[model samples]
Target: MAIPTTNRAVVATASGPVDVLTDTELDVPTPGPLDLLVEVRAVSVNPVDVKLRGGALPGGDGPQVLGYDAAGVVLAVGDQVSAYAVGDEVYYAGSISRPGSNQQFQLVDEKVAGRKPASLDFAEAAALPLTTITAWETLFERWRLGADSTGTLLVMGAAGGVGSIMVQLARQLTGLTVIAAVGRPESREWVRELGAHHVVDRTDLLAEVTAIVPRGVDFVLSPFSAGMVETYTQVMALGGSVVAIDEPEGVDTLPLKWKSQGWHWEFMFSRVIHDPESTAHRELLDEVSRLVDAGTLRSTLGTRLSPIDAATLQEAHRLLESSATIGKVVLAAG
Candidate 1:
């Protein structure tokens, strides 16, 4: 395949809100020996995407493109790439190690790319990669909850991006009773529709979860990392585990130690960013793809924007930052 000259991208040179996310053109990147060059069809706006662009990497030199989830067709492949070829429709959460999918094209490792789910459109598929990867990795890889434990698992903030998928994965893939913690009345129906066995208001997380489990939840998945550690620890059964994407602020491990419990931190980017045991990430995403294709899973994109341009992307970012979004938000390239 021939290389393209330039691609449209949302570039961030400084930190702030949607205004910081600007449009620019840059030379399309060439794939490395083990990379797949993907012509991005759709990209999802995530909190991490906003954080990285808005504040996480403040004082950066040049434009830093920010997007994690993407579904696209392969335009080219590197010499060492064996899993994909040009024109393959694929989706995957590209590694946080490099520039993101806010651009028209991106180079990602073949190991991280999976054939796009047959059931979804580009916009919908774009929403699945990042949050799905996070939920799958956190539950299966980190919490190890695929067994017929018959115990209850609590998912906090069950109406949000990662939680939306986590609820379905738990109910659809595992024998564990699924309890979803949602604060809003409006979101309760969505959580239940997603297959949550029980839905509780987040304001009364402990009481609500205890009402279902009696003892405590056997596992807790905290997608909201917004200082809910103490609440989770209180409602988690003895020896039950808690998995989080980011650490809760000012949380102490003493409570967890007393219960002989465990806390696992899942940074989905670890594999692609650091390239640590890269093959495991490949294996997990492959399984995710299979599950999605089999109809056991669904994409989490709650809203879609068009054109994949600067203005549309900026709006997506603003919406994501509001923290009120029910599910994943995506930008589609026509």
Candidate 2:
């Protein structure tokens, strides 16, 4: 299929509320060397999208296209592109430096994109990239956990998107004891279904976690770590590490010093944008594709919406902001 001259996009008029997101048309971008001009078929909403759209996070002037996760078919490839062809199906959590996947046609770097899993459709594949990359980098890259590594991995917000994949990956790939902590009792069973070794209450972090692991947890993937650093320090094992996907601002690392514990942040785009030659995102997604195809992991897509547009996107963003939905929310681009 040929690329359209003008492609549909939902652009934010300004960095404010959800109403800023409006339907618009954009010119199809020309592929550069090492670029894949993808025909975006599916997209997934994320908390970052909400943050950027709602002025919680600052972006460039005027309206901006907001998306991270996408599954699409390659319409064309740049002359220098080597790994993918015109018809190849690919998935990626695109670079924050570029225009996002909220458009019909978009260009993504070949090194950052991966082959979509054959067992999953575009929507399912779309749900994986952003959250998968975040979780994989947090567990494997940031924490430096290997296949042979064995310890207690505490997924602080285990029912959410990143934690969902992190729990499954830790269970399937590593020899670690995975403890999925949910804020509510209702989410306990959901986390168990994702193969968490233990489902504990995240609300009662200190008492509940201590009851289960008397020695304290070895690693923690915390979603909200701003004011809980002291409590987390108590729950962590000696020399253990904690990683947060969200802003860990206002957090004093002093408490961790006594225990020789560490607190780190994991943003998936950092490696791709800063280190241009990095192939970690693609490699992670490729391994994730193999895992999904082999029935080792499952798609975390929870609510599937339809016909990618401003209204659908606004709803998706709203849902993510509520923090009530479990797993991921994906929108079909048809």
Model 1 TM: 0.94
In model 2, which range of ten residues has the least summed lDDT? 54-63
**Residue 243 lDDT in model 2?**
90
Candidate of highest lDDT: 2
- lDDT digits (tens) for residues 35-94 of candidate 1: 888999999888887777767763375568877788999998899988888888988888
| Residue pair clashes in candidate 1 | none
TM-score of 2: 0.97
| lDDT values, one for every candidate | 0.82, 0.89
Question: Can you give the lDDT of residue 16 in candidate 2?
Answer: 85
The top-ranked prediction according to TM-score is: 2
lDDT, candidate 2, equals 0.89
Candidate 2 per-residue lDDT, tens place, 1-334, comes to 7777998998988888888999999889999999999999999998888888877434666577889899999999999999999899999999887889999999999999999999999999999998998888887789888899999999988989999999999999899999988877777888899999988887787888898899899999988877888988899999989898888557788889999999898988788768999887788899999999999999999889999999999899889888788899999976
**Backbone clashes, each candidate:** 0, 0
TM-score of each candidate structure, all chains considered together: 0.94, 0.97
Regions more than 4 Å wrong, model 2: 56-59
